[model samples]
Target chain A: MRNAANLRVQVESMLESRIPSALTPKIKPPLESMSCGISDIDRFKAFGRGTLVEICGAPSTGRTTLLHGLLAQCTAGGEAAAVIDTSDTFDPVSASQSGVVLREVLWVRCGVPRNQGRALSRLDQALGAIDLLLQNGGLGLIALDLANVPIRDARQIPLSAWFKFRRAVEDTRTLLVVLAQQPNAGSSSATMLDVSQSSVEIEESDKPSVEKHIDGDCLIRTLRNRAEVLRGQMTKPVRSVRTIGEFSTSLYSYR
Target chain B: MLYAGVHLPNFPAQAALRNDAEARQKPFAVVAGTPPQVRVVALNSHAKKMGLWVGMTKADAETQSSVKIRERLVRLESLAHAALQDCLAGFSPWCEDVAPDLFVLDISGLSNLMGTPVQIAKSIREQARTFSLYIKIGVAHNIDSAIHAARLTKNVLVLPTGGEAEILRDAPLEILEATPEILGILHRWGIRRFGQLAALPELALSERLGQEGLRLQRLTRGISTRILSPTVPSMAFEEEMEFDHSVEDLKSLAFVFHRLLGQLVLRLATRALAAGEIHLTLHLDLAADGVTAKEPFFTRTLKLPVPSVDVTLLLKLLQLDLEAHPPGAPVMKVVLHIEPMRPRVVQNGMFVPQGPEPQRLELTLAKLRRIVGEDRVGSPELMDRHLPVPFRMANFTPSNSPSRKLPAEVSQTAVRIFRPALPTSVEKVRGTPRRVRFSGKSYQVSHASGPWRRSGEWWTRGHWGRDEWDLVLVSGDNKRIVVRAYRDLVTGHWSVEAEYD
Candidate 1:
């Protein structure tokens, strides 16, 4: 009978050992994926619907011309565009002559107060108008023209403020462009397009008298510096300037 | 009471079946979408016998064994949970799915009835093998130790009373659930392994790593103070409708978008939640070009605002934007996403009359933009520059606020014209005339003004050099036209740059 009980005990033990535990538990974590890389802008030609680009330069530079070309390209491609005129400098006739579709372009004029007693007050009002527009979102390109706004004042803008602006633009499809007269010292996130005038040359003359009629050409230089390529070829000090018109001078010189 | 915990790597049951059918006839491997990919999803002993390794790519495995492949029907996780519950039902009334391949079995009362902790673990392993599933067992004083030992050490780890710290000290940092950023920080600090972290002073760790450091310290010591809270029911509400046929054009896509928006709005209205953002996804048929047996290309996720549930408004916006800016090609399918619904509440004023909220203005503008097109609306902003005539303008989006203060010096030096003088018609004379006719009027050049010459930006391609003259012209009708004329230094032609409006 004892031997029989031993065999039963062995069978019971085998069965008891088969039971699973309830103390331990398993948990799975979520998986993360990799992001794709950015290719050349030209590769995204048809995909430039909401792209924003900025052109910056010193006095007598070609900032406006570049903007005109971009607008003309968009219009030529049958795409509509809007221009916010803070300095009241957009010449619609000239834009039309440059192959821009007049019907496709919307021009908004933000007037600088003519009767502002002080220049500083006028600047403040102008900037305030721009500030108001930026607080509202949803534009393919929002270009803030600071060409007329002096470089000193542009630099006076705190770095922290630019950082805030960058953050606001983060992850949004909209492109925020800032045009400046000079390189406004700040972080590398802001794309800087620098325009500079090279030289003036007289190439032709219509009249041969003492008061000689002259034809002149102006040279313009464009430099595009972005954050990703800042460390490499950007250090090259070479500047490219293209001559616009050549002048044939009789006898004329500036003091 | 005897309890057993079974872990069948990832998709082990299906993997076993696939292997058994092939009978070492083909090389096979399982792929789990995990990093390093070394952690085996599953491997059949037969395939292993053919020198095939787990985590090998499908292509590589086929090249090796030329085996007939069978994909798993159910997720590895659900199948393992069901299997574990079935096998351990007698030992514990409760069983929990711990992870993709692990489980927790409550065997507290069964320890006395079972032979010994080691014997119980062995029996469990033996039973699991019958089903072709491999499991690691740990017999510890508590759940934390048991789980740690089961996951970290070997098949069977019996921890002594105070050996928890020693057992876990040599483990890798990956087991700590450390983020990439935190891991980088630890690596820079020369704390490569878990033992180094465990040996650090709590005060120093906290000061350097902040709250995360404190949590890491606790985890390293195997002192998981966190309780396993019961899973809460998901509150997310989503509805999906499958199309009878694959959609390939904008019209069909728009139809789907309309239907989806209606359903989403109805659901949101019932919940009293206002959806601010919506995401639309399209699935395209990919089998059209005979590229594969599957359907052709499909598009997904076209995000838009969710201010109103109006299907017409949504459709109009979508159609307009698409016509103005169409996707690269025809899209096949679409899915709409309405995100983060908040309680719809509007605070009204009792005394003073309330005006429309700013958000309403946005909606109105959005509608106008849809009709007129986005590029047709906005205020003109000056292109920041130190140049004249060639000033660029930007679209006035309300969000481009000036975050920084303008310097006082710059405002003083720059001359800002209120309006760009429209260059009206100019009378061309044989020579540089003292006075010129403009706008059907003549004016005497009072101060035959300046030759303010400006040259072109040649580096940017286009160039222009013009000698400008600010002529104070007075007409016979007594009308004054302060005209600025420039003789193009390049073309030898004269043109009026600006005229006083």
Candidate 2:
């Protein structure tokens, strides 16, 4: 070890002009990461501030569940979060069951009566609300829920508006997550994910079935979505192997 | 006790133009009477120079194109007077409301906090200027002397002990507000100035003017003494403005609201307070045909989730409110009243993660409320009920989110609820649902669980009974999905309630 140290010092002295501190390793500050309350998804990379993420899935595909989990993670840690629900379909009961601090979340429900025409107005209002919230720049998380919004209605939103949202939240502490049925943010989103029920091979006991596991009865049990996440884009440099992320965890503790 | 008296000169005229900086620069007269009987009750210095005097008919005043005429607003005069007392009360606690235009404060102990007598008097004059009152301040060793000295001075007069009598000698005796009979007797006695009244023999004056004579003598001499009748400071924060022309556009009202809210904020801030709630009353001008509502005032109340002193934010809130529920008619006058509260004092922890700033968040929330309906934007609070999806929206405040100790890592499950549970057609055999159709798709229930019975509120009109089940449905393409389905026993209807991912 002494001889190696001497050799290293001699090599550093020889390479001093070409490379300063050749023997020392440069330290980089660790990226500030936020958890979406899912271990499989969080392991890939540290998702830091100043990024837009999109969670797209079909109905009953754990999209709302994952959004609530992100909200729960954000609010339980004393950070304020907001949800711009374009369809006014947020369930506070399920969110509370998921450990989301309701008081910490600002819910802007842009739902209009069905009798009231102009489905396009709801989308516009939601987008305008997101812009306002972004311009003020303080919330830790802002989730725009377009899950119930029809594809035709959601597509009416101009691409430039999405880019504006991306630009507004850039380099800020806000983690803007857009929840839609399909990819609407396109290239503006930093992290893109597609979720569906996992096709995990069932055991012999429940052959050819998705094998339902019922904890205690709804008599006194909670409902949670255990969706399999297929990551589309990530913030880190590496691609996820198989992309089997725990996008939404199941909280079957109590009803 | 050393007393300081503040007297507002031409108060009615000043009050009529207090809110209008432009009108204050011109000749203005406030006339009060019945119709053609209307006469000039008060006139500004400019109006006085233009030959406008008290009791001059409105027609006579209108003859002078240079003089602006306004109907006397007793309300404004009272507001100005209260504002003056509020200003003086800030300098000293013991303030006596001697008259509408006159007030005296016992400034004996204020030197420690406000400095010397001269400084207090100058500060009083400056503070009163914000309320748009032209004031004359008098600081003397006695209350009556201070009152008389205040009446005699153009601005501030600090009279030493025994010096008020000499300074007030040249002042008009009309400041006493004597009766006409006494005025006639004083006129007959050739006593036009206080010096003549003070020089009269006390015994002889009592013989001619009765007991009122001796009292007048001491007051004229500026040697009078009396207890300061201090009034209880009323906690009221109100500001109002009347426009020359009825304002029809909301944007135009914004200009008026901005100015009024600024004054209210300044007054609240001076008292170390903030407005917890604001009530705006816009007096509307009805159509000449009387088609509009008889109640001409359109009222709106804005309750802040967090009391704030940010004038811009308050103005934005008012603007948003006015835009949302506009007074259909033109607004002729605006009255703003606020419920004062101590501004929130929060010492954020250095390690705590940042939340949206309280004030900016409010502004953003207000803007969001404008886009969304008023009742639609807020925090969702779950209500305790037997019904499915029970919750109400609550105003969001930064402090509402509390810090909690979290485990090293937490992963929780969530369910997506169908706001209006999707209606479904059930294919049942022997009281068992074998298939379901919803959203234009038919699904085969390959695996199903027992019905979980939920029933409550049996005594109320909204009583409900439902049997819920977890169904694992397989689509045509072999795509599997899990959903919670329910059947309302009361209606015997089946619906897909929520989905577990």
Candidate 3:
């Protein structure tokens, strides 16, 4: 009985040596989405990768405020972003002031049209530029600034183009943000934020024009206003551009 | 232990025959010197069979038989010999170039890896054949014996160890390179065969011929062993192709390019390397009418974003670049040279977001550059100045390090600049621009601040002085817009410089 037990043990050990140990394959975790860093905005929604976000509003509606917020968030997070400016309207001075790492952002300026006659071709050029940027993946966010281009010309951008952009960002962790005069990406956008100014306060400047005024005049009214932020689909009626005074126009500086 | 010798009798002719398939079939010899004094410097196997030899007058050879003579390129012979040495290095690292036509390789331990002596010889012969070289290989116990066996044998001869003396016994003494005086004395003594030399009394021979004769006897006995001082082998990863006719179509040219790139990539892979930069040289076929015919050489370098051996990616990049900058004339010849580098080994962090392949990003950037002007594309870099729009374009190279998390404490207003500031007409009230007309629209100033003055570069051209204002304007529809308008103090012109978002 002892000999049989020894033989059995030997056979078991040999079998164990012959069979390789099984290893568990590593499962990768999901990547985190980039946030705009605004308490009200980031809390409500974060700009996920492979998604399109649109921000459009009338002039002084804080459309640029949101755009800069996203740029600062991306650059400060140590990620690179590109802005395809259709009207050549990117200010580096203000971008740096907003905590944006200018080194991380690729700014491409498509020359602005001098008149309405050149607007159509200029828009086409901008679209072509955006297409190139979209294909060059590795960016955290690609903001298409078409706010200065006429809304009619921007609307002329076919749905197929938007669909192509949607497909390009599908598998990659890049957020495509379109800043236009109005909602243009339509249903192709995953999140839409419509900004519109509700009121304007005219504050007379305390500095006298008599000091060193050019054109021999003084004290132009200073602009002060609040804008409403409507988040969701543009087709919905529940979202309105009514100011709850949550937004401020005061100078926010960080050294 | 064993050694081997690879000897090509007429190296110059063989080197010339390389890559010329049609010429190899006919009897040919390479002639040197000018005109009447020209003599045959090297001959091929067919010419040898026709009783032609090197140093024969070129005129005499041409008259004696139907033979074609080509100018002997001394420079080409040197380069080809060096290339042959590099090719042989693939088999064994130890190779000594005893002569321009002959090389001895240390093949002692290669039998297990490459096969028997005959198999190894055949493999080396095959490699030489790629360069259109016909060679004889001899394997023996020592380098000198291997050289003698290779020079005398038709193809391959393997002299077993301890049999070198016996094998060399029948070989003639003329094959030995001895001094003329020693040779005359040996001839007078009738010591012709190596066996006779080996049988000579060592003390007598040494006393008569001194150290020279004693060394010769030792060589005849095959007892000498010396290390092979191999040249430092350089990597050659370049290939050239000349089309039968000029290739006007890009597709045809691309097809040829694809094949050449594949060949080069394979060569790099053999050496465990990757191409850092692929330089392409195109020889264009100029039109008959010499209308501003620029020198027909057009060259471009495709610098890989990252060193890679992947053929598909490289081909795609080349295709895109060529499409952007097409050749001015039809291409007759294309030569590709690769700067080789070791492939980078990257270990990605587990938590890092996977970015696009560097090669892919590079290709895309190139395409963007083509679409937009070169100056218009790339990352934005802030220039050192307080001037409005102090920035320039720089190359876009994204870092692969871990993403930085900015503290929430820092926040500031962001500003976007207008490339060419918009021209505007302003209505000044109390020395402030209270109303503005821009883009065919009027904005009633709701509130405004600043007449901040700035000026610079007064001594240089493009001197500038400007007064800036931050304004909030309300249109007739009650829509409000914030803008910064600057007045050029020199020209007294007001323009919208930028918009705040």
How many residue pairs collide in each prediction? 108, 6, 16
lDDT of 1 at B438: 44
On lDDT, the stronger of 1 and 3 is: 3
lDDT of candidate 3 at residue B304, scale 0 to 100: 75
Q: What TM-score does each of the candidates earn?
A: 0.31, 0.85, 0.74
Q: Over the stretch B148-174, how does candidate 1's per-residue lDDT look in tens digits? A: 567665577666556667787887776
Between candidates 1 and 2, which one is better according to DockQ? Answer: 2
lDDT string, candidate 2, B278-358, tens digits: 999988889634335467889999988789988888998898777777677888899999999998888878778887877
Interface RMSD of each: 15.6, 4.4, 5.0
User: Candidates ranked by DockQ, best first?
Assistant: 2, 3, 1
Indicate which candidate wins on DockQ: 2
As for DockQ, the candidate ahead, 2 or 3, is: 2
**Chain B TM-score of all predictions, in order?**
0.39, 0.90, 0.73
Candidates sorted by lDDT, descending order?
2, 3, 1
Estimate candidate 1's RMSD in Å: 29.3
Score candidate 3 by lDDT: 0.73
Give the Cα error of residue B313 in candidate 1, in Å. Answer: 6.1
- Candidate 1 runs further than 4 Å off: A1-255, B1-242, B246-255, B262-316, B327-330, B337-358, B363-374, B386-448, B455-459, B462-464, B471-480
Model 2 regions lying over 4 Å from their true place: A1-29, A113-120, A150-159, A200-243, A246-255, B34-37, B65-67, B109-119, B177-180, B201-214, B242-246, B286-295, B400-412
Candidate 3 lDDT, tens digit per residue, A1-255? Answer: 999877766766677666532232334344345666455555445366677877777766666766777778877666788888877777766677666777777777666432213343566767777787777677888988888889888888998888888788866778888888788876677666766555543444356655644532223232233433454432233353332333544342311
Number of clashing pairs, model 1? 108
